[model samples]
Target chain A: MTTLSVRNLRTHFFTKEGVAKAVDGVDFDVAPGEILGLVGESGSGKTVTGFSILGLIDPPGRIVEGSSIRFNGEELTAARPERLRAIRGSEIAMIFQDPMMTLNPVLRVDTQMIETVQAHLKVSEADARDRARKALVQVGIPSPDERLRAYPHQFSGGMRQRVAIAIALLHKPKLIVADEPTTALDVTIQGQILFEVQRLCRESGTAMIWVTHDLAVVAGLADRIAVMYAGRIVETGRTADVIERPMHPYTKGLIGSVPSQNTRGHKLAQIPGMTPSLLRLPRGCAFKARCPIAIDQCNEMPALEEHRPGHWARCWRATG
Target chain B: MIVYIIRRLMQAALVMVVMSVLVFAGIYLIGDPVLMMISPDASELEREAVRKALHLDLPMWQQYLLFVNDALHGNFGKSFLAGQPAMGLIFERFPATLELAFASLVLSLAIGLPLGVYAGLRPHTAGSKTIMTGSILGFSLPNFWVGLMLIMVFAVLLPDLVPGWPRLPASGRGATVDVLGVKLSFLTGDGLLHLLLPAVTLSLYKGALIVRLARATAREVLPMDYVKFARAKGLSERRIVGVHVLKNIMIPIATVSGLEFGQTVAFAVVTETIFSWPGVGKLLIDSILLLDRPVVVAYLVIIVFFFVALNLVVDLLYSVLDPRVRLESRAT
Candidate 1:
């Protein structure tokens, strides 16, 4: 059973120049107590997909009709705005990159946390403060009382991100869409946050979608990995299987580009060519030009097919 | 807080000392007030007596010394024309200007803030475009011309168009009531009617200024990650705007509004002239033309003090709105 099931989801931006399809016909299911790493290059649709699940897309960008997002068996796209709002902070939560920018600089930590609690729950101010203090403790923040009274600017970068995570955990949400929440942090802090988040998800049975461009992060953190390109997922599988035996050439290229001890003192291999502009994507497999083994069969876009159990890739020619 | 206030007062005193010297020197260069006060046909002996009586015959430095001595003793001499204490004269006209400035400030904020926030929130809408265009007119039009047009429209044209419509009085403080020994026109119906025109005329420019400032600042602050985070938390749109957006934008708005209030009080000469409102601005203009040294110096010194106090208030207001500023000040 899944906490969230997205099917044929298409989020497009209608600008004056053209309709840029940011997320095109994507499908994924996140089970309770699972972490799904949505991996991509900078221009890929991972962040947009995250936003789509939250129903947080703003104007000029919209989730096209017929796209279905079901959370806990309820259709999210068809829900009223108030209903969607009701599900946002309590049932589902989001953590953004740059925690320094995410917290209001003018407000105290307690005020921000208390307001978040009050936004969904009808608790008294004292109860909300207690919840805030508890959430801070859950995130391993020391001296929660004093920290709650301090403004966001008073905290260091890592501390601020911990506070943001605390805010997300305040209601023990069932799902969290973290858009590179630790990407701006130091490597050590990143490891600490990943551990805390992994433990929190397992303990609380909450599903998470961690959107980032870093493959190494997802390799260690996510149960499954989905690699995207040009608004489509090119490959998704169990993290070990995908990392060891990537079916899609694009995923293989992505894994090759990461520097490891084996590739020490050697120039790292990279996918040749820039990420294709979504406004003017090539009319076939978006990765055809950059694919090392692209063939005539790649002239037409390939549908995702399971080449092995629980491992899927979008490519015409794939053999184990 | 006590230390802050004490420091600010000390700075104000230094500024006042410098201002007094400049004003004293500046008035000396504006020609003698005795000439303006005395009859043109007066004999030479009579002119000498008048100049000595008003201290116009003394050397500029000696005259300034006497003025400072009396000023330290809570005296600024008397107006050459009215023969009343110059400070007393200014104080009498002070209420009218204070009330007018306050009314204008209230009107501008009431009208400007919402329209500006709407424009900022939806910059592409037709309504926002229209407001932006109207603000341009408010900014570009000369104050006197706008004041005259207001008179032509509301005072002159509206009454003619609709019979039995109460025509707003064109000039003077109308039908004042005594409040705590102060004559206040706004307390009475006729006085409020008379106040409407000048107040609106003065508010238009400030209102437009506020609109542009609010719109720009709001647009800048609206997209901040905190604002988006606020939305993500499921807080209602009203709370986001009220607490997050409004509180942040209020820093710049408070500063501009405070300085604007001081400016209106001191320099609303054109509006006062068009509406013939008996305010300090009108009195200052009349005093300048008559070259009444004591009144001119007294009015300017009071304005300087007013500005100093306003700046202090704005700084305090900034601390209230933003905790970062409060924390920094406390640390110091």
Candidate 2:
């Protein structure tokens, strides 16, 4: 069974100026034990998609009508708040970008973890602590016993992220929406965390949506990749196909701009334009102004089409 | 911690010495107590005798030296008018003022914290708007005017309007029960009733201060990533607000509350006078009018002591609320 299936999801922010469609008609799915990398630049709504899955959108922003988010065949967009909260951190979990910001500074690690356990399960304090200790060990944290008594600030940057990962893995959730969990970390630490996360997901058979802007990061870790632009997924396919045989012009430009893709001592390829503001999008294709292969016919909005097996692109020229 | 406290105590001793010097020199400039004490019909010889007896004839430096020596020996001289030891007089009234200050502090925390949290959490709600507006009124109104208005409403007007309402006495501690050799008015029902009006009047401004502080801090902390993380952990709304939001906001609240408590204790003068409460603040004002040097000096010195002690308590509380502070201090 699919761990998550999102179809026609439109999350909009109703500001005084205009309705900003942050996530516009997005569709994707993750099978059990699969890793889907939701790759996008800033303002592309990758994080918003993650938050919507958890029903964490606050006032002035909402998952509009006609959107569907099904986790294990259960519709989440229409679920009650209590039901959504129950599913969160137990059936589904989330990990944020900044580890330093995620854990409560005033609370000790054990206090935070124990309460997290008690929030869903009716377990004794000692039992909860025992589980927390085990979770910490599973994430490869040294001195798990003493570390539980320390505050968030006491740990180094890498260690803090390990704690956050441990907390997310405590409930053995079936799905995790990690939003750039290692972006703020150093390169070595990022690799270590990626390795740990991949190992844990494989061991637990947990499906995960890894949201990031780094193509290089997902190239190695993600089984499939979904490249997003202007709040919509422009192209998606298996990681090897998306990287080596990119169909959409936007995805080609993204893969070309990576520093490792070009010959040594050569000027790196660059995408020409900034992301369009979501409040007032252009009339037809959002990437028309920036697309190098634009023609007179590019004025019309293109629909996502499968040009190859299990590979989709949102461009008219993909078939040609 | 012990070293820190010992250092703080040494600094406190220095501050008290400097404060005593300033108070001594300042009081000397205000006019001779001998001039204000004796009758107008008294002869020059009587004035000279009074000056010598009170040591007013000595140089200011010499007088201060004598005062310091007596203070070192736990004798802060005697009140010129009352002919009683100044420390004894102040100590007798200290409990009443402290009780009033503490009562108002408790009242403020009990009322202000919840309202502030509510206002911060749902800042756009109508009830929060009303609470914020009331806090603004609490801040802007003068203490004496608020005290008078409260007296007029609860003590004077309400009793006249409602036949069954008891006529609240406008002044004095009604009756006191001695607990551990300190007279407390809150023990008996009538005494508590007598305390109610003055306590409310005293608490309003401080309560408003705490509300603004707590609201601002809570608003700042509510948007922190830790708070959102708490929600993502499947925590109930109440647990998120109570544990995460409250704990983070308490740092600033504790600091402001401690300083404000010290201020109320030192300067509840207008409230004490309006209600005719025989507390240290009233005694201070009376001593100033009578130019009772020893009593005024003793009062100010004690206030300084309270401030230093309260600051220490606040720092200690900071360690408890924030572990970073605790660990760093331990490291040092």
Candidate 3:
């Protein structure tokens, strides 16, 4: 069953210059226990899509139009802020890139975690503390008791991110949106966090949206991958299919740009030019200007069509 | 922590010394002591005797040393105008000013903080815009003008318009009132009722400042990755704003609040004049006008002491509000 489905999500930001079409139109679904990686570069609307789903976008930026963000049959798109809040932390948790943002600087780790638990569940403070401790231990924090008493600043960057992950896991929410949670951590710590996150989600049958720019990280973790560019998803498919046989030029560029894939003596392949600004996206295909294989037919916007089973691409030439 | 405290104390001492020097210099630069004491009607012998009695014959350094030594020994000399010891006069009036300043500070925080939080949480919304506009207006208007307007409306206009529109006391504290089986005077109790006009006048600008700071700080933290994370975790808007935004914004707000509180205490001079409240601000102004050098210096010392003390308290609070700060400071 589809645990979460987002259809035609559109988000825009109103500025003095003009309205920035951040997430023009995007569609994806996360099945139960599946990990969907929403991959994109900075300002690709990946983060904006994640925020829109959570109803966390601030003013000037807004969800202009969207429909059927059905999480277990409930229309979350139209849900009130209060309703969203109740569903948040309880059913759909998110892990941020910066742990300090998750962990209150002034508050003790234990205090914040316990309060977070109690905020959703009607359990005793002691019970909440116990769950928090257990969660901390699960995240590989040594001496959970001692560490809980420590402040966010007391912990190293990696440890703080772990604590943030622990807090998200405390409620065991059905869906977790991790927006490059471990990007700031060291590679080894990142591996550990990724491992823990994957294991936790699989064990709990929790659907996750792992938004990241790192294809390698998604390659190992995500069940499916969606490549976004200029406020729209250009391609999406099963992880293996997308990685092994990338049809979209942007996805191909991204995969080829990976440092590890390059030969020892050869220079790394990088995608040419910067991402198109959302404020002034080009006519037809947003990536047409940057596409190596662009043709005259690329003047018209290509719909995201499945060229093969479970392999979607938004290029007319690719579909042909 | 001890080292930090000691360093701060040393700085405080240096500030006090500078304050004393400025005070002494200001009084000394005003004029020669002999000319001020002598009159045309007085003979040379009498004028000389008067100068000797007043210790005008001593060198400038000796006089300053004598003043400092006397001050250290809790002697502020006699007030030239009042003919009473400056120490006793200040002590008698200290509580009134302290009470007023404390009341104004509390009022400002009580109104300003929540308003700021509200304004910050909904920045572009009508409520937030209204608060922002109001605060800007409040901040720009002079305290004395506000005080006069308030007095005009509450004390005069309202009374004339409506019968028995409780006439607010123009000078001194108001009458007593009973509450919850306690006979509490407005002046002696919390002074809340009597404090309304003066407190509002004093707190208007401060409250506006707090709201502006709170809104800016809260708005900044609201969009942080952690806030989005918390929301994704299914945390409510109230929790997001109250727990996360409020706590994070507090460090900055507290800083501004402390400085503003000190400023309000210093700025109370004009408000006290308009309200006729017997606070330290009024006392200082009166002393300065009367050219009571000892009293003026003493008032400066007191004000400086309060300012430094408030700053110290704020610095200590930073550790409590942000552990990262404490740990980083300790590590450094």
> For candidate 1, lDDT tens digit of each residue in A1-320?
89999999999999999999999999999999999999998879999999899888988999999999999999999999999888888889999989989998888899999999999999999999999999999999999999999999999999999999999999899999999999999999999999999999999999999999999999999999999999999999999999999999999899999999999999999999998889998878999998889999898999998999999999987765
Best by DockQ: 2
Off by over 4 Å in 3: A13-19, A60-66, B32-42, B175-193, B327-332
Residue pair clashes in candidate 2 = none
Each model's chain A TM-score: 0.99, 0.98, 0.97
Top candidate by TM-score: 2
Off by over 4 Å in 1: B1-3, B326-332
lDDT of 2 by residue, A231-253 (tens): 89999999999999999988989
| Candidate 2: share of reference interface contacts reproduced | 0.69
How many clashes show up in model 1? 0
Q: Interface RMSD (Å), each candidate? A: 0.8, 0.7, 1.9
Q: Looking at model 3 chain A, which ten-residue stretch has the lowest summed lDDT?
A: A98-107
List TM-scores for all candidates, in order: 0.97, 0.98, 0.90
